[model samples]
Target: MPNHVAVNPRDHKDLRILEERSEGMGDATMCCITFPEEFRNLQNHYTILFQLDQEREAFNCLAMFGLENGENLFLDNGRWDASYVPLAMDIQPFMIGRPSDHDADRKVVIDSDSPRIGKGEGRRIFDDNGIPTAYLESISNKLSHLDGGYRASSEYIDCLKKYDLLEPLSIDVTMKDGAKNRLVGFHVIHEERLNKLSAEGLAELQSKGYLMPSYMALASLSNLSKLIARKEAAAINV
Candidate 1:
């Protein structure tokens, strides 16, 4: 469990965050939650898909990084190979929080238990004057965007559901070494249904700026082949 506390410059003056990409910092994952706002950039490097969120009882978008559990092909050594890291992945050990449900204002919160939390050899969150540093400012921006994107995701999912645009996706990969892997329990945009959508529906989606993201999700499937290629290369090196 995460020990989250509201960020305060006075209390966390000496706090710093290690920004390196590695499994120890929790980067070893198959996928990360993504948002439509980032689909354009993510489509270029990741296979964007949707999965059923039983808790939310709705679909959640994802940016796939590997074929199986605890495998992030994008994390090469200490670097992330992708050009655009999902906000969910980039904003580590920090999150947006509300004081209470009645309170509409949001504030920054930090995970005190995260491996990234450190006092030495990392980026400082606050400077000598107890003011937020440039890195902290960037993190705040990412958190804000992530918060907004999370809220907007519901509306996007509703639109796709209304249009009956989601379809189950199952991928089977056979590596050169005769090992097999299967990716299941995910969904993708039904291109056929999207193509058959009524003109009124199309206009409505366009007006709400949901059409491009729908297309972006469809385009992202192209990267699945690239991901598989990377997996094969990793196997060869191993």
Candidate 2:
């Protein structure tokens, strides 16, 4: 299903260009809908409609489809507007749910054939296989209240340094969004000691986008911070 083209029957009639009815609104218009690479993995086709006002106001209408069997699938309305990064944060339900005292052994599995997570839900489930074969109604019900966002602060870095798990890396910042003053920095790990880094060490790196494992693999050897310091010292003739 590389490219799909659909015709709108309502707008198929040809009107004379000289007529007043055709003067304001053009008769034939074609819309090319392109999907970003990230969304290619989505199994089902989705349609989104967006409306914007003069004051930069925006609203969205999600298309809800009703199948002959009375099943429903809500298509994302933002598909035509901006690219989105799909995010899935691991959940621990005990903390968020009351009591926070569920035994570690208690766990639940959601299968695609399960009625609660019907066939056409919003959050689809993919087997370790190449294709997504299941759908889940909600991740919230299965979630345990384990708060999991742990960013590596400077103190955490100090601890990692004590274990020799962290070393100084290069910094390269990209300024792409001037309006937001957003800066993306890269901290490259040296190839010699990278294999020694463990899952816990990688978790610390995950706190900063720049420290992603792929960046470690492709980062330059030269340390930008050290180079700046050396340049300053030489300028002062120290």
| Model 1 residue pairs with clashes | none
lDDT of each: 0.92, 0.27
Q: State the TM-score for model 2.
A: 0.23
TM-score, per-candidate, Cα-based: 0.97, 0.23
TM-score of 1: 0.97
Please write out the lDDT profile of model 2 over residues 1-238, one tens digit for every residue.
Answer: 1121111122211211111111121211111111112122221322211112236332211111211122222212212112321111112111132234666442323221222222333333343432322322133332322122111223433433444543333334332332121111112224445456677766665564324422322331222333233334433552
Clashes of 1: 0
lDDT of 2 at 190: 41
Best by TM-score: 1
lDDT (Cα, 0-100) at 136 in candidate 2: 20
lDDT of 2 at 13: 18
Please list the Cα RMSD from the true structure of every candidate, rounded to 1 decimal place: 1.1, 21.2
